[model samples]
Target: MAQFDSKFHDMTEGIRAVASLADAADRLNTIVESYGLETAAFLTVSPVYEEPSKPFYVTTYSPDWVKRYIEKDFFDIDPVLRHGLRAVTLVDWKEIDLSDKAVRTFFGEAREHGVGKHGITFPVRGVDGDRGILSVTSNENAAAWQAFLKSEARDFQYLAGEFHNAIGRIQGRPRHQTVCSDREIECLKWYARGEKVKRTAEILSLSPRTVRFHLDLARAKLGAKSLAHAVAIATERGLFFQKLF
Candidate 1:
């Protein structure tokens, strides 16, 4: 018991140490692989339904699957994800009703894309209304799948919580702001170019305090956890391509 506890501790610590979202995704893949699972994904939903959904995902699924999933906007209707988002406890895929035509079609496509036959989703409810779902899938037969879940479900929940907390720590705060002023845009550009507040202030002939203020506003507008995340969001939206680097 002590040995297993130690190992779990080490694993969660490694997750907390990840430096980037991509690195965190890779780590999730590693974790699922270690557990003999086929694939896994951690998904976060934006509170406002109409807001442009930023890529807040970590998944071990194939690129083809990822692209198709996005192109189809299938997430809005995915039974596993929809339930997990609202479910207070872990949701097992096998237990859910699959009688609906749309649900059947969705699962059929999922299997074609190499998603496994069995799965479970652990919902994570965080402070500040942030929510996420950690899903694990496998190709195992029904009996074996149930046995595996009985043994591993608790541990999976713990790992999901750790990963969520790590991501939250990196993100700094719950992002919701979505507008930036002209000066804020300027500050973000300079910051993206590796300009510190002091250097950017000098270049813009503004005080360091003013430069920082603009950057902070931009970060909030972008709903970024940090300036680095703000830069990533801007780049994703073609905000950086407007000006020559």
Candidate 2:
């Protein structure tokens, strides 16, 4: 493996240069290869109206495995996914509460599909109520796995955060536009530039509620599930930057 610092620096720059979600996902595969891992997956689920919307996932796992996982609806019983939803910190696959038969069966099936016997997952909470998990798996023995974790867990955590942020920037959006008004566009523009809701409201000389209304409208128009997602879509489509000038 390359020196940790150098590998991390390279991965950071590489992810940033990616122009689309597909490219970002490809870069993640490269990063995982550097770590000698068998697979890596980035999964995000955004909440809408207090319920989790559909999951958006990018993974280097085999198509057959992914197909079976979805066909069987294994997500509901997969300990990794279940724990990742509520975990605030890194979780080793071994540490998950897998007393349930369904959970054990899920892992057994995963291993049968070459999904690796060991892994660690980082659970991420985005600022706009988006949840994500960055998981890397290995088929290594216990001793080797422990040593690798001891030496590189921190670097992997940093990589996970960077990978998640990169996906946030480059993920595609719906092509349809719902005809946003000038106020909605203005609010989205400021929000995309990293302004807080209150700050954006102040800049636009509008009430916070009004700003939120416009932002929500903009999100709906763009067919985005979250505010950050909307901003990403808008930025990617050059809607905001073009309007700013």
Candidate 3:
């Protein structure tokens, strides 16, 4: 029992040290692979403001599924996702019906890919009004997959939440916005491009005083001691989409 306890502690700590979303996903894939399970499908969703029917944000998903879903625009017929949002706990795909002809056709096409027929989806409620879903699919029976998920539920949920939070911070949509805004984002974008405040002001047809005001605001929003520090913060938060160097 002591040895088992030690191993559990080590596993938890090791997973916590994963620094990026990609790292976390790879780690999860490795874990499932180790158990002789093939996890070909994984997806995360967050809240989207427009379209009440489509309030969830699909933060990440398999590239193949993304293209197929978009090309087909199956969101309108994705009954499982629609029902899952209303469920209070993790749901199994088998429990939801795809009896509708359109829904049935979509699932049939998805099956041609490696995506599983059944899976468990964990709903993640974040700080503020944001919410998300972390789904894992398997080709096996829903009951068997659910049992496996139940055994590793805590670890799976932890990894999912960590991934989501990391992405949120990188996407500049963190639960707690330390320093970020539209003005700060604009200033940082210009700063990254090697533009001085005077030149930036001239380009924007603003006075030097106004440029300084924007810069100051950016510094405050970024929690930076200087203009350079602010730019660094913005870059890490994914505001600078282009390569600076």
Clashing pairs in 2: none
Model 3 segments more than 4 A misplaced: 1-21, 40-63, 141-143, 175-245
* Candidate 1, run of 10 with poorest lDDT: 173-182
Task: Tell how far residue 4 is off in model 1, in angstroms.
Answer: 3.6
lDDT of every model, 2 decimals: 0.75, 0.75, 0.58
For model 2, the stretches where C-alpha displacement exceeds 4 angstroms are 1-4, 48-52, 172-245
- What is the C-alpha lDDT profile of model 3 across 77-189, one tens digit per residue? 77656665555345666777766888778878776755666666655545444555566667666667768765655445444455455546544674443233354466567
Compute each candidate's TM-score over C-alphas.
0.65, 0.66, 0.54
lDDT of 1: 0.75
Tell me which residue pairs clash in candidate 1.
171-225
Tens digit of per-residue lDDT, candidate 2, span 78-194 = 778878867755789988777888878888888888787898997765545566788989988999999988777655655665566666665552222224456777999888788
Off by over 4 Å in 1: 1-3, 47-55, 174-245
TM-score of 2: 0.66
The window of 10 residues in a row where model 2 has the poorest summed lDDT is: 172-181
Q: How many residue pairs clash (N, CA or C atoms closer than 3 angstroms) in each of the candidate models, in the order given?
A: 1, 0, 2
Q: Return the TM-score for candidate 1, rounded to 2 decimals.
A: 0.65
